[model samples]
Target chain A: MNRNAPGYVLGFMALLCAVFGAGVATVHYATRDMLAANERLNHNRVVCSAFGLPVEGRAPADYARAMEQALVVATVPDGRGGARSVYRRADADPPVVGFTFWGMGFWDRIEGFAVMTADLETLVRLRFLDHKETPGLGARIEEAAFLDQFEGLRPDWTAAPDRRVMIGPAAPTQAGNRVDAVTGATQTSSALMRFLNEELERLRALDWTSLEFEPLPGSEP
Target chain B: MSVRARDIFKAGLIGDNPVYRQVLGICSALAVTNLLANTLFMCFGVVFTATLTNVTVSLLRRHIPKRVRMIAQVLIIASYVMMVDTLIRALNPDIHRFIGPYVGLIITNCIIMGRAEAFAAQNPPWPSLLDGLACGLGYSLVLIAIALVREPMGFGTLLGIPLPARELWWHSWTIMLMPPGAFFMLAILTWIARSRTGAKETSA
Candidate 1:
């Protein structure tokens, strides 16, 4: 147990290195391709989910194929800087402005991306993409019940994406807007409301006047 | 290979169970057991580190300097742990993410270091190797026991994958996968082991 000796130290070092070196060599040879493929797929799937798109069942080789026909990435700006949206399917005849949305909860961050309809007033689709919040408590943000609440949401005159959701049974204060928060997750809901406002205001400030609206393939009324 | 190896293996599995007996690797047992797959990976990592560390520590004990031996021992342990981390990142990166900092934390697991200082530094290489393997298996056994209950109860499934349609009948005890559940499970396990083995209070 005594630690001061030189020969003991050298011997220990040699034995330890020898054993670990062998382990590394074995692992390197066995798992090189699998790890690389995992990292690539994980990143791609998150991007797909960000746009309300799905990629769960597809194998790695099919990811590029999914991206080709399914998604469209557009650059949009926030107060912080510009953001992008890779919409799963924007069915509008003329595509409108797109935005990336995000929020902070008690434990971690929640974020997603969305594509708006041609008029810039209605939502194309919204998806919650990433979060690291506490399981069962804050993690409920990932639940479909919470996410589906955002499906038809749109702006009104008084309730700009500027004000936070007051939560706890406060009715939506304006037309074309709603505010029924998830039970036991008020703080998270409120934060989401605030972030959405900030993101929307930033979207409003952008100079979209010069950008041409191309008629989208599926934007039929 | 020898009777000693078998004895060491058996001791870890039954005589000196890590989670239920010594309760040595409880931190990971609690945190990762929330998912069966995570627990299984943690067990694999611990076993690998303990077995290899023991054999090396034993082989080198003769030349280790009295004053500087602890530092060298640490260097040895850290080397193995880091190597595990790198290989995971390179080979099994998905599991690596779930394992997170625990790979680095393995150096401080006390079990590996304990075996090194206790038996490895004193024993021959073969026995040392067996002791390491035994300790790892022992740790895995207790962890799997906890995982068996915790995963199924918390997530309403076994391991990361789901159970058969028949077992879908079980109700989820949501807390079984939480931190408090770990404490409860560990306590119950300790009680069971002590009562069954009639272990000496001072030793446990």
Candidate 2:
């Protein structure tokens, strides 16, 4: 319904819209560095929790302190099934065996972090960091019962690499080192166990003798 | 004034209501009204942008070139949107997060655009501002109404304000938080509003 008054006015309006959008994007850019830091810290806390490292509380403010006690490390594997430290903690010794990884799943991205012992043969702790599977169905992986099965799990996935962490057949009271998978979440359990199995195998192929694990403050020796 | 201030207010509140009548800006209504607190924030941001942009556009309508009116409209809407976006982020960081990018997306809200074009373009500046405010009020009222109905049933609570001694006795409408539930509830509310107002309803 608006009939033109001037051509330049259209140009001015286009220019203004550009400026406004650019301004918003620039604001995001200026804060990009800070946001990345926040995300890194969030990911760290999630990894720590997976490895069962304690945080002060679940509050956002408690994240930095939780992160201070833990660190991230990457392992570059050699052909012999042993991983070398590509990355390690700043505060700790040479090799930090804690690492986090993720992959696509049926519903959402599935990811977690595992903190292995300096020997790389023991999975001392792990946290199911993130997932978007059905809430009551597949999401049980984030719960403690499902995740805790891996605690003190003798890096078995590395050595035996072919076994499944089955919830069926019988209870763990009769088994040697098997995890009792969550009921009603068979697919989720399989995906996680498979992911963990594959990742640990890859870690085992890398050289671990060169890395140092950070000493967790006040952790029982 | 070409359009009366009373008409400005009444048209937005009842007759030409953006949420119920025109169905122009129901996105936020459907998305944010699942919780009372979320609906409240969404409504407030819409109101702020609508009112401010209406005034700015109405003031500039005469000067704006017809060919570039759309572009001019964007700048006015975006400026106000950014101001509100920044203010909300600084004031309520948690809700800012819970609501996330929805607050910024208010810039694209068709309510602001529709009002700017239909009402603000033809009305005096003062009346246009009132129309914007009333439109916002109408949106807020219906959003709260939907939220009041949905939240209690969905979460056994109101606006995340927990009810004491509550049990999960009633089966929750699992759909309420999903996009389909929003469409369903909004459709029902619009039906009620049109039938009561005796106005012909047009789907958004």
A1-221: candidate 1 lDDT, tens digit per residue: 54545565677667756766677667666766766677667655654554444554677645645554454444454456555542434443555434567767665677765556645566545555455554455556666777665555666535535553233364535435665677777777777777876766666666665443343334323
Residues A1-221 of candidate 2: C-alpha lDDT, one tens digit per residue: 33453456665577667766787677666666655655555575666564445678766556655655565444455334554433244444433457665566556678777776655656656776556565446766767877677776664443357452333344445454477776787777777767766666666665566554544444334
lDDT for each residue of candidate 2 in B29-120, tens digit (9 for 90 to 100): 77777788888888888898899888878987776777667768877787777766665555554465456457767878888888899889
lDDT of 1 at A221: 30
Query: What lDDT score is found at residue A63 in candidate 2?
Result: 62
lDDT of each: 0.68, 0.69
Q: Worst lDDT window (10 residues) for model 2 chain B?
A: B89-98
Per-residue lDDT of B1-204 in model 1, one digit per residue for the tens? 577667788787888876677768777777777777777777778888898888877877776776666776787787778667766676655666566556777889988888889889999988888888888888887777888889888887775677677364877887896788978887888788779988876755
Model 2, position B61: C-alpha lDDT score: 76
Worst 10 residues of 2 chain A by lDDT: A86-95
lDDT of 2 at B151: 86
- Could you tell me which 10 consecutive residues in candidate 1 chain A have the lowest summed lDDT? A212-221
